[model samples]
Target: MTTLNHYHYKRLQEFCSSVFVKAGVEKEQADIVAASLVQADLRGVDSHGVVRTAIYLKRVEQKMINPKAKIRIEKEDESTALIDGCNHFGAVVGDKALKLAMKKAKANGVGMVGVKNSNHFGTGAFYALRGLKEDLVTIVMSNASQTMPPTGGIKPFIGTNPLAVGIPCGECEPFLLDMATSVVARGKIIVAAQKGEAIPHGWAIDKNGKSTTNAEEALKGSVLPLGGPKGYGISMFIDIFSGVLTGAGFGKYVNNMYENWKAPQNVGHFFITIDVNKFMDIKTFKHRMDLYIRDIKTEPKAEDVEEIFIPGEMESRRSEQRKKNGINLSQNVQRELTNIGMKYGVSLKDALMLNHNTEGKGV
Candidate 1:
């Protein structure tokens, strides 16, 4: 594994941004995509990080992702909006939607927004965190191409369908829950494949519905829903909210980002924001949240347990540490990044060299 300091990571992000710009995306929009991807890596969610650059570039080359997309509000009211992404990068569209939702929530106490024709939006938590600075509770969800099957079925009919929620606390860090309804995200399998590692059983089934351990095989198969029927139900509802409600592609109509290079993904996302001041004073809400988190953390632990963690606590800690100490990237990821950099006429080695003078060290 290679460790890269925050400075190096930033350089890498700039390189990615340059690639997007070369592919015809506006500089500002390219920066947004790069930042979103790097933020995932900073938070230790490598599955949604810079590893996706290759595929995204391919999509742009194929004209599947509209680099010059003009995202616009199709319909709107005081507290709600429908945005058409026009097939732009998901990060750009998601950021616009979240800001709109936060603006409405601040004015009306609550806000809801739906997005259509977007691409993959790094991580749901990224958008959910938009409302945190405003002392608002935020919920974000997105529907992907079919990768998981409903309970008692073998064929893939629903996507991983991730959901995230962020709630601010007074003394503790905000409570954030970001997860896929599937047992594991498809990106996890892709990562395993990149590392030439075997996947765990029960995470997915082969094309014939048999459990598989080979990551490559799992990629061609179907991921299992988390907790069986419960996860399936949650995923279905997410599809309805993010896809059906937004008039975006739903179920089989959604195109796979990796498979269908010629067509837009038509992915949909849903966002909701609630201002805490609407229900009670912001101070009171924060205090209650702190108390709730304290109780949960101080509860007795099971045997062999060292400590308890609130949602988003571990990721936040990792982000802070990575910013100071540096981030570790696997050799495979580094090599892939180098290739991408070369394609864009940038020297990854030079970029890393420039970071050696920074505060942190890279290995």
Candidate 2:
């Protein structure tokens, strides 16, 4: 795989912003969208990173997504609100919802927000982490397009349906966990297809509901839930909160990723934020959390287990290295990005550099 230097990645962010501006997104909103993508890459969520630029551009060209959306709060209560995203970019809607939730939390000690008419937002964790600085525990969930099937059914009926949570820690990085409720995210399948590689069995079923290892076959088929019915159940709940509560499209009503170019995906997202200080002394809670984490780390390990790590630890470590050494994107992604850059008159070298650089900081 080829790699982009740090400065180049920063340039990518700049490019994204510039293009978004050209497409009619406000400067501030463009920056937020770019930041969301870069943050995903920083946190090791490669699927949501720079590779998505091409998809966004195509969506704009097809008019499936609004290049310049006007978001507004449709309704509001003391501790909850509903946002009409006006078919904006998911990052824009998500950031707006998070800000609204935090504001309500400040006023009521806890807050929740539901958003609709959005597109793909990056990793759900990016939005959840916004609560950490405010001494709040945050949860973010999104109901994506149908890509996964029910536990025993053959046809697709649910999206990857991700759930993410962020908690303030005592001294370590905040406890952030973002994961797809499915066995694997559709992004992985896309990556595999790009590489012309086979996926592992159990990841997905063929069009006839039979298990398959070929990425292409799986794409025609349906992905599996993480733990059979248990994962399916959780996905359903996520769907209810993100889609049902928000009154967005659900189940088969959701738009197919590639097929629908002019219709809003009608994607929905939910944000739950709770101020930790409202119930207990913030310091005391931190101290107790620290003790709990310490005990968890000290627990006995089985053979072949060199270390026991919490959810966010590995991501933090990978981020440090990638920030310095630059990320090694898969060969297929590199090629695709290069091709897209060519269309926009951005040189391959410039695109690579943009992929490598940090967003706000100049390399």
Candidate 3:
């Protein structure tokens, strides 16, 4: 097999969902997980995409994730609520939580929800985009197993702790910002290690605490916090909001989804939804947002910069391109997916092989 090949997103999603169902996940939930993973691939964030399916399946096999676990609200107020994920897949928990927030926001202009006992929810932007569907602005954040160290420290304590925001811009697509507090998401390092690729300097250090470009060494060590202490500070608040505040795992207490076979991850997430009409007329808000984005993007470019992209614009473009042209899956990821599919009785060749005439045509 070559180093890379293109696959239709729908085909990939169906393959993933089938594998999940064969492994005993309900059909609806399986679709949710599959869509979330494919959404990552579509947006060029392959780190959170289908490459994660192997680990996700392993967690299921080990009973670390409850495929049919119930998601329920534990407490609530007009504009605030707390929900328990029941150790379900992270995307499932996030979907329900974000929807609940949206429901509340529709009624009260603003809604906030904290989630507990969740598993690794994929990209936060998945939920952010959900908010965009309803013309709402949403913020989504989550804390993962510790992989980044606090500034000036060698030992890992805080998670990369990702944050994402989606802002509706009316006629244009929503403005999206999604990122990890660490210089790079740990999943990217994992992907590099899987592909035998080296990471760039300043991304991480070896377990020995020396900066290293080797992905495996970086995995053994810790990814660097973005901007040093500033990134560390942002991580603290993310943990506070998505973890501590939710009464879920926090600091170093969250179990690792990869290493901890004895228990559920109990990961946590926080979501905030704002309804545009509640604050201003929808027309005015959209017009103002257009002006705001234009003002920032049309400014003078930095040295050698040809264009400036608003937050999430690049990803949105990547998504549209991938939708028209298929997604790329590395050989290593393909092998793993094939192996897992075989275990579940799905034909990898049938699922991945594409007809040339339909290639990159969103088949």
Error of 3 at 258 (Å): 1.0
Clashes of each: 0, 10, 0
Best by TM-score: 3
Model 1 lDDT per residue over 1-363, tens place: 224523356776788898888778899999999988888888889999988988888998999898887899999999999999999999999999999999999999999999999989899888877678778899999999999988988898999999999999898989999999999999999999989999999999988889999998898889999999999999999999999999998898899999986689999999999999889999999999999999999999999999899888899988877665655667887788788777787666654633466455533
On lDDT, the stronger of 1 and 2 is: 1
lDDT of 2 by residue, 1-363 (tens): 233444344556776676666666788988888878777777778778877877877787778888567799999999999998888888989999999899888889988999988888888878877788778889999999999988879999998899999888888667888999999988888778877999998899999988899999999988899999999999999999989989888887778757686587989999999888888988988888788888888999999998888887788787766665555566666677667656666555654544434443434
Candidate 3: residue 274 lDDT (0-100): 96
Off by over 4 Å in 2: 1-8, 351-363
Q: What's the TM-score of every candidate structure?
A: 0.96, 0.93, 0.96
Better of 1 and 3 by TM-score: 3
Candidate number achieving the greatest lDDT relative to the actual structure = 3
